[model samples]
Target: MIEVQHLTKRYGPFTAVDDVSFKVEPGEILGFLGPNGAGKTTTMRVLTGYMPPTGGKAIVAGFDVFEQPIEAKRRIGYLPETPPLYPDMTVRDYLTFVAKIKGVPRADRKARLDSVMERTRISDMATRHCGKLSKGYRQRVGLAQAILHNPDVLVLDEPTAGLDPKQIIQTRELIKELAGSHTIILSTHILPEVSQTCQRVVIINKGKVVAVDTPDNLTARIRGSETMYVQVDASGADAQGALSQVPGVRQIAVTETRGSVTGFEIDSEPGRDVRRELASAIVTRGWGLLELRPMRMSLEDVFLQLTTQDAAEPEVAHE
Candidate 1:
């Protein structure tokens, strides 16, 4: 588990991370997202013991990162934006060196190294010098090293960077598999990846925590109303008027039309369900109920809404 309390980082007159705070539960994959220059890297650096914060505190795996740097670092596996690879060493030798430094038992080093390299899809490149590897291979090598020791937490900054689409998929699956054993903080600019991979999200802006919640909760909080998409086949009959009569239906507009079938976007009062009423009305009128489903806001929409607004007190989600 990891906790950050009022963590702040400053450089002379500039504050890179300001009073930021959040937590990653044991075995949870938390997505760390922000626009460029939003202090994502700065915060990650402090969390990984790459640098000390100006104020506040960070704890990793039961050890205060600042107070017990050695113990905390021992439990954390970090893959920074750029893979730290030695130019002259082959991938096997490089990982072997890292294994020793990270305290991988000498007896199990070979098996661990082989498993990590294979899982990261870099087994074929084991004999290749790290510096000679293509960007993708280097990134894979970086990932292999991070998990070689199977630390308690993984702090990955763009772990999928430089990977091809297939490689990206593989990495995503691997990260998902690592959950329940490794508490992960995945910081990336890829929105879709966060939505698919992270259990919760922490969106940062201007060095401050802007939002913290599950993706679903953030979408619901930002949307402010319930929206539904409905399609009806009534041969151009005014289905909108019929739909408007349903209780809790606040607004309606046609979104598409194809012959006798028509699609409608409906807005309902918050916490209300109008599907039953809408469906009955359509059936009673003998109009074909083609399609009907809730239209939740996309993660991108939520991200844009939160980041574009003036920084507000972070909307934290609780069970």
Candidate 2:
């Protein structure tokens, strides 16, 4: 349970976070998304009590971050963008140190360290020095520290930033396993990670909250129309003419053709599927259907639409 109300953070003349508000329900995984200078890290820092906000309040597990820093922090685990680690110390020693500092009972520190190491898949690297570990391993070590105390909430900033593809998948699976037991705030620019790992998403831009909802809802809101990409065996102009006559066809764009196959991007009105009509039209007109597939905008497209464009929300993919 995390609640941020009118949270604002400023540095001199620059405002990093401005009157942002959101709530993370218990056992929910919220994906925090934003562009390079969109105040994601600033918000996380404020919530984690790493720094005091210029204005507003942050409550973690029912404890005010500023007024009750100790209790709030004790119930929240934070992993920053850059893993804070002492290179000279082995992974086990580093996590053990973190557990102690985070107030894990001395008698429970060993079992706790071993458990986190195993959870993060860094058990084999327990004896390896933090400095000598690869970027992926280092990230695992950072995660191990964050979970060593098993806090009620976990705030992770780009937890999979430097991992390989396999490592990324493994990390995502681990995160999925932790979902129900720990409320997590995962901040990452990677769209796929958010789509696959988070239950809900929060997109912020220009120091303001743009949208907060399920990824499917956000994408559906932006890509309001059903789009289909078809390659028909006919002259490009002829193909367009045939498709334009389809009952639900709203718009059509002539794209590049491959060999004798002519490519067309067709859009139908909301809640309509024109594939059957498209196929019949091509066949009745004596044209061969080379390919027919739907085109759904990815989360990256949604991110771009909301962050880069002047629009206040994710833009429609149509021209």
Candidate 3:
């Protein structure tokens, strides 16, 4: 539903977005992740036609964003970092105004407003002044306005930025529910949110596309060795020796505790499953095995590796 090719955005001597390209298919939710000043917002602005790129092209729903901006934008619902709201207006009035600007027909404005208000759970606050609402309610109001036109694509920037934990969870669930029907490109620094709500991710750093793949695939790619954590009733030294003797075991470190118990982390070659061998070794050595489990890399670890790796090398502009 969205395609960006060789997209570059520059301001004078500095480049805000550097030759970044990616695609988002129908029913796909792509998580756009980056650090502060990473050009995530800049790229989103280019896609939304809020800013034009210095070079290359972007297409939304089969329409070129630059060539046919109005038609492209008509199919996109954008909720920017700050909700573009008129604080003086009541929730109902503000949304009604948004509907008109989005070109909702006069005959359909009322029903459109009603549906969006209900979808965003802001119906109860229809008569309340926007400025008088709490942060959560205001965020919901922003969401209502974004979807007021029933756009095919939703570009949400930090949809849960300032919400409380409960509200964040609710917002994530809402976004998940909206998937399949709406092609969404969500930009946020929250890793857990991406893991929970996005099927694929595109990581950006220094205004360049650093990595792109499903969260699990990215993490699995960086997982060089298999690691297992084991607890047993044995001295640290003895546990290490027994585990080291297991076939395929490359490294082992054990921590001794009182009552002959030990905690150990074992590292072996990638794709190796030595759990059974380790258990057999423990039993033969008369050590009581308390725990044995594989250790998987977390999203944070994967993010750090990919971003840091890119930082060390010369930046490669994508097309």
Query: For this target, which candidate reaches the highest TM-score against the unseen true structure?
Result: 2
Worst 10 residues of 1 by lDDT: 310-319
**Winner by TM-score between candidate 3 and candidate 1:** 3
All candidates: CA RMSD (Å): 2.8, 3.1, 2.5
Worst 10 residues of 3 by lDDT: 310-319
Q: Is candidate 1 or candidate 3 better by lDDT?
A: 1
lDDT computed for candidate 2: 0.89
Put down candidate 2 lDDT per residue, 182-240, tens digits, no spaces.
99999999998899999889899988788888898888887978899999888888788
Backbone clash tally (model 2): 0
For 1-319, candidate 1 gives per-residue lDDT tens digits of 8999999999999999999999999999999999888899999999989999999999999999999999998899999999999999999999999999999899999999989988998999999999999999998899888899999999999999889999899899999999889999999989999989999999998898888988778887888889999999885447988899899999998888898889999999999998899999999998889899999899898888878888466655572
Best of the two (2, 3) by lDDT: 2
Q: How far is candidate 1 from the true structure (C-alpha RMSD, Å)?
A: 2.8
* All candidates: TM-score: 0.86, 0.95, 0.92
Q: Which regions of candidate 2 fall more than 4 Å away from where they truly are?
A: 311-319
Q: Highest lDDT, which number?
A: 1
Worst 10 residues of 2 by lDDT: 310-319
